[model samples]
Target: MVRTADEASVFPDVVVASIQMAPKVGSKAANLKRSIELIEEAAGHGAVIAVLPELANTGYVFSSRREAFELAEAVPDGESASAWIDVARRCKIHVVAGIAERVEDRLYNAAIVAGPKGYIGTYRKLHLWGDEHLFFESGDLGLPVFHTEIGRLGAVICYDGWFPEVYRLLAMRGADIVCMPTNWVPMPGQAGEHMAMANTLAMANAHSNGLNIICADRIGTERGQPFIGQSLIVGAQGWPIAGPASKDREEILYASINLKETRRARHLNAFNDVLRDRRDDIYDPMLGTGWPLPRH
Candidate 1:
């Protein structure tokens, strides 16, 4: 319920709810039901924005494209997304949920943002991880931010969070907040390591770009692979306002984001200004002709 200066705001703070739930593999109806329950709970709590983990509607780690496609659904026509849209409109909030999208005949790891106005925007997973390349098509849609009642929201699916350039581009496009719906697997003893990486990504990117970064990661073990749920909310200063918790239970992390802080941080550190300091003219060789080095 965070409101800007121009609007008469009821809620002065921006509340974001990040959901961590286990998705039933290939069961669209069950997944949709769980998503709806979480969305309703978040909305009831007066959250202006709610984010679910990547592939929330379908468990990740599919063995074949057919399996992935079987779980995929059309954009707005998809029952899961459509139901969330109704909830968003009814609750008057913004929702960002991940789904396996069936685009014509191709399948994609997609994230859809819905509000009272219906599906506002969609971002397909730009960076596939491990065996993902074998089952889904990489998204070509460029990084773009969507203007919503909450604020300028940008999204990057699970694997895409590993990249820095994406955050830079989103920041350049005037994103107040960036959402990452991730499915990070926790190695036997590497939970701390994974959380550190996620924290670094959130803090470094937000502090440098002067944008709020929220990540909703899946919890619990799926197919015997443990997922460490560390859903968090980081301010523009790269500090965790919410969490970096373990994966034993489901919890809602809330933070009141002040857009004014972004401007203040940028004024003080101004790391984004570094982008303007770049000399593209001198780096032309980096974008060299399409040729591989000679394999002598």
Candidate 2:
């Protein structure tokens, strides 16, 4: 439901769903169909926001740049994006999902955000991983926060979560929640018992920023590249409210978040606030120039 500003103030709690699924390589139609079905299921279960995995429609592990280009489409105007917008409009919920975005001859690993009101925005993956470098350009648009009745929303993709700056920038802009669509591969030396690095990063960032984060991951092997699935929803306090679902399962994890509470939690005590405590005076103003020395 597209709540009015007054209604949002009256109702601060919003249920979010993280959909974990396996998208077959090159099977765009089937993947989108499955995504729609899962989104409908989330709506039926009372989710106001639904997040899907990176490359949810086209799948990961493309064979070549040519293959990736073939799967890519224009944002908000492409077939995949249009279908998702339609589903969001029909279900009366917000949808954040990953797609291969084409802008002329260039392609990007991107996420499209849509709502009951229609298209919202897109977030291109800033950090590329492994073979992705061969198929997509690094995102040029810096982190952007989108305003909604529920609260301010932001998004990042896969490897972007590894950098604290991504979450910090979003929180600095007053974001209450972030949608992460990822295809997590087993990290180097990852054992069966160790907690997935992706989940750990989500929890730590959410706690540090006092922001809710929904991480939706894909499962299964595509062209011999296996993806780990442990999709989860983290509360502002950095605790898992729903799941680190099974390593290889198609499921949706749900959690209810109160934007007011999330914003309120940033105050660690009377003397400190997470964002307020940052010593921006000493930190480098120009990002990507490497760390600067603190001024005397």
Best by lDDT: 2
What TM-score does each of the candidates earn?
A: 0.86, 0.93
User: Model 2 residue 61 lDDT?
Assistant: 89
After superposing candidate 2 on the true structure, give the runs of residues whose Cα lies further than 4 Å from its correct spot: 1-11, 286-296
Error of 1 at 94 (Å): 0.5
lDDT of each: 0.77, 0.91
Q: Judging by TM-score against the true structure, name the best candidate.
A: 2
- What tens digits encode model 2's per-residue C-alpha lDDT throughout 85-139? 9999999999999999999999999999999999999999999998899999999
Model 1 CA deviation exceeding 4 Å by range: 1-12, 187-194, 269-296
lDDT of 1 by residue, 1-296 (tens): 44467643632457888887777577778877888888889888888898898999888878688888887889888788788889888888888999888888888888889987777989999999878887788997878789876678999987787787777677666788888888887544564455656667788878776778888888777666677787888888788988875566777777778665554555554454433444556754333222232111
Query: Which whole-number lDDT from 0 to 100 does residue 229 have in model 2?
Result: 94
